[model samples]
Target: MITRVRSELTRYLRTETVGGALLLIAAAVALIWVNSPWGASYQTMVDTSLAIPALHLDLTLADWTKDGLLAIFFFVAGLELKREFVVGELADPRRAALPIIAAVGGVVVPAAIALAVGHGAPGMDNGWAIPVATDIAFALAVLAMTGSRIPVSARVFLLSLAVVDDLLAIILIAVLFTASLSLLWLGAAVACCVAWGLAQKYRLHTPLFYIPVALICWYALHEAGIHPTLAGVALGLLTRVRKDPGERTAPATHLEHVVQPISAGFCVPLFALFASGVPLNTAVLGSLFTDRLALAIVLGLLLGKTIGIFGVSWLAIRLGVAKRPVGLEYRDMFALSVLGAIGFTVSLLVAELALADVGAETIELAKAAVLVTSMAASVLGSALLLRRGRVHQARRDADQLPQGEGSTK
Candidate 1:
């Protein structure tokens, strides 16, 4: 019975729909809990402090969820990214150019919109990055649910686009958020990364060796004033993605299979629970419109993402720089671009980090903006997807019908 239960649990964790549902449920719980009569208790729980003095580590429950647990999510992202670059859709420059260009447009346009709208606003310096990421799990979940009739290549396009989007977001985080630099700790982190790469090269497969090294590298990055989650990305990219002769699976694929469940089932939902507890009071709701920072985020997500992704993609195809995915028309690409605007996970992280130095009220407003915009994008994208899906479904049905049966009619 225990073995059976374990197998079922693993299956549930591996399902993207389940993972996405859990993420949405966690965020909803956070919102409701924070706005409840016992809202103060929610804040207290998030603020509860923990420390490891020997390691010079101290943080609140919220910090741990954001900075520590979320690393697992990023690690899984890095693994997907490496696999794609090595052997997936991104392996071919012809197939990769479209998503790569579209991902850049997705990032650049939203940031430009945010900067233009929020000029001189408090926290606008870094808060413009809030809409620059695409949540892979959530976006993929929505696609899986709504776009079943869409071509298989549409899913591949979205996946490749999201992977590149995440890579850009990670780069922005490392560049925009690091306020101080410690050379010694930075060197230590680099050394640990080198050791990790060597372990992969020499085929060291033991978790016992890797677990400690990963921890030390994470701590070193923290001490060096770089986000510790970058350690996850570095290690994931360094992992070997190619299989040896007689090997069952490549290390990257195997690791993704193992760690993805943990990241999706636990790490992301926990982080959402902690990071998404923004107060939705009347003032906060009003400020979502009145506050420049909030308005920038909303518009950046809704308008900028759509325009950037679709516009650049159209240009690319027209100019013969890239071709659209198989069986996906311009309208379908537009819907996919709207789906790209569902910027939940990394967007929330950026909201927190970008507004960290600002007051709590500002931070809450930013997070609320992210939640609101992401939901809007999801709804709008789903509508577009369902419409496009019906079109494709009808086409498929017609093609599958008996030959010339409707000609007389």
Candidate 2:
């Protein structure tokens, strides 16, 4: 089970490794389009509405990226989480405790920082959740660039932290960002989810059979005034993660293989393209430093994420609440914490929701801050990891030296 999980994760990391580069390209294109004289055309495309009158699915292209496409992304997340809990490393309580506890610290401290900064500016406090996200693909892509001297423990630690962090972000979205609920639609979503669960119990493996089930959940959640991407989470957890006795592969394992390409290659890059494209001008550029919202976002993602993630993780170890994985050092964990601060896609999503009522100007400033801070976080993390990787490599070479021959020099 562990080997299979590792294989799946390696494949995922590879996809994200490339997807991160593509995501950057897509975001750059969007930014250029929106800032060009044809910028109005980009806005028009995002605002343009598409509807399936029969299914009652009506949304702008931008909305589809969030509600429709991101659902697939979250579904993949759900599958991996369930797999981990069932048969992967997280099945062991001791193994799971470190990342989960540390993830809590990561979420809380960043929000506290954002809250502190935002409190002085009335109406800016609602965006506390904006800094609580980690852009998994982008962060992993940066890690992938660090080369082979990086420890396996570091990969596992970062992956574990990211999973738990994302889970917290999802809860924050559900609890704080959701406006009002329609019980009828919410109940309908539950019913569809229940039916999906039963299908899993029955080991129904066909996508044709379950795709409609997923759509019903998505549609219901949309009508319930909840984010429809959550429907993916629901269905993903319901999928079987273990093969039956004598059975070959888990349904979830198979589904992940099928869905990953679609989510990584198409969904996420498309979402980044639509969501990123904030028009930059003298006024917008100037507002980043002038506005409290921008300051909150910048500080929260930069200083807050590092402090929150590393402090909590270190405290957990010191308090004996969690044990460090072998080969992982405090500084290595700190490097991972810095990478955890790359709150790109999810951070932007939260900014949109957190600033939905604040005004267009506030939204744009928050978005710009998220973009700039994510890049800054990436650079900072890379510098640390690069230094560490070289030191690690040197130590490895010295260890390979025979009979301390190099010490004579």
Candidate 3:
């Protein structure tokens, strides 16, 4: 049994993409169930009351999934963000320019666009951050379908871009999204996080020591008026692992290996089920487009993502901060830009926060908007990527032809 578990673990670690696909599947299932005849049952199940006698904690299953399970997902995201900044492509300042610039542009533009559409509308301005994220799972899936013909630089560029986008979104949530503050608890949370950081700096050999501290930090932040999700990022950045490929392995990498799967496989999917579930009655949804929530979400994602990512990427290449990816041009990247608009995981989370206390009707419309735009962006972007691959292949084939054999000249 142990051996079988080991084998499965090894396989899953190697194929990280499967975890992402599972997340998508979970989201799809939630969407279907919510819109089905049994939708009320699904809602009831998620909304059922639950309590932990030991901890004196009480929340609906759905809230627990979103606030609790999703924290683990963000924790993993934080680790990935840290890993990238430490040694990945993002580690290099020069190589990082194109993606960073594109990410900046992508985030700002969508936010501005969302703001423009919903300006002066009640509770509308709060949702500007919804469209600024790029779902790594969906982006990677799209890239994989393009085959090996796409240059490695392009893939690296996209990955780096997404990481940067996540970073921005995290900050936005911490700053723009939070409404109140609890200074006393906030200080306690910071202190705990600081102690964790000191442990890493001193090469603390034990990972277990950080767990209790992290829990305290989570609760402290929760009470401190900071969004609890920020705690994940704090812990992730504080944990460092050094990789010594030949002789020894790094502590951070080892921890990440264990943590990443849990985050990707279990935490992220469960979070999606909770966060992304929204029931839609056609009659109700038809009127949603006119609402501030729906319009902000839809336009923010569709317009902000494309212009922000591609526009800045082009400028970066032109300004010589970074070179364009080999065999990929402005047009190819534009397609990838669209793909970045599929903001399933993060968008919904932000939407929940944005629509907080806004009433059930408003939240429903926001969810619908996210659902519609995510689907549209995915389909259109995938088609463009596939088409681009065909064009690239045709060009390659023509180049390989016998000298003067197929030349029109």
Candidate 4:
């Protein structure tokens, strides 16, 4: 059994597309089970009490998944982001411009829409940043399930857009969601982060030094009223390997090869189960349509995201600041814009923070709205992409044929 498990793990580690698909499937099953008739039992199992001696820690499974497992996901995300900036497409200014502009426009328009929709409502204004995120795992999962029929350029575009969207989400979380600031703790976190960077400069290949420093950073950031996970990003960037385009075998790739699959295959799937699965009830269903919080989230996700991503992307292409991707027309871009509307994971995370002090009813309502909007976006975007793929293939085939052959025949 152990050997079989190891073999499966090895296979998953080698392919990004396959590993991502499996994780997503696990997440989907978890979601369905969480909302099913047996959901209460599942919730109970997750919420059962447990205590850790010496550490003075006691929390439910769900809480641990959110605060603990999700931190690892964020850390991996930070690592990937750092890697991209150092050696990937983001290293080129011209190639990066379209996604950067699209990300900014994506964020701004959603926030504005949320603010407009949620205006004058108590506590709703603070949640305007909630819908600006793009859940890369879920978005990528959608594309993966649809197979290679989709263009490679579209996938690359989606990835770049998601990366920028993540950066924007982290910024919004820092600037908007923070409750209070502690300069002393913030300073400590910064110093530790700087030390980590220096350690990297000294070619500290061992992972030991980074672990302790990372814990300190996490604690300090927690004390500073910033979410503890932001420290994961900070430490990740500090320890991230910055290489020239051609650098050969290094610790960075080694670590990615070792850690990324584990994080994605295990931590991410667990997070999906824990973070996304919420018990559905009348209150949740009712709030999906009526509550100020739910309404803002739904509108921001469904309407705000589509309009923002498509509108700014179109403007960029038209203004010559960015060229349209080869083989991807405006129609395809619009479909991808709809895919950007799938805001499940981060939306739920933000919902937790936004309604932390509120009743469970409010939180449940917000969750339902997120689920609905995310599902809608995924379905609509997939249909449009599949249709566009057929069209593109037909055009390509037509272009490849010898001129006048059809008329002569």
Model 1, which residues run further than 4 Å from truth? 404-409
Off by over 4 Å in 2: 1-14, 120-125, 403-409
Which candidate, 1 or 4, has the higher TM-score? 1
> Which of the predicted structures, 3 or 4, would earn the higher lDDT when compared with the native?
3
Q: Each candidate's lDDT (Cα)?
A: 0.93, 0.85, 0.79, 0.77
Worst 10 residues of 2 by lDDT: 7-16
Q: Pick the candidate with the highest TM-score.
A: 1
**lDDT-better candidate, 2 vs 3:** 2
Residue-wise lDDT of candidate 4 within 266-367, one digit each (tens)?
A: 777776676666666776777677877678889998899999989999999899998777777889888888989988777778887777777666676777
TM-score, model 4 to reference? 0.89
Model 3 residue 134 CA deviation (Å) reads: 1.6
lDDT of 3 at 349: 81
Clashing residue pairs, candidate 1? none
- Rank the models by TM-score, top first: 1, 2, 3, 4
Worst 10 residues of 4 by lDDT: 242-251
Q: Mind giving the per-residue lDDT tens digits that candidate 3 earns over 150-170?
A: 556667878788878887898
Of candidate 1, the 10-residue stretch with the lowest lDDT total is 400-409
Every model: Cα RMSD to truth = 1.6, 4.2, 3.2, 3.2
Looking at model 2, the pairs that clash are: none
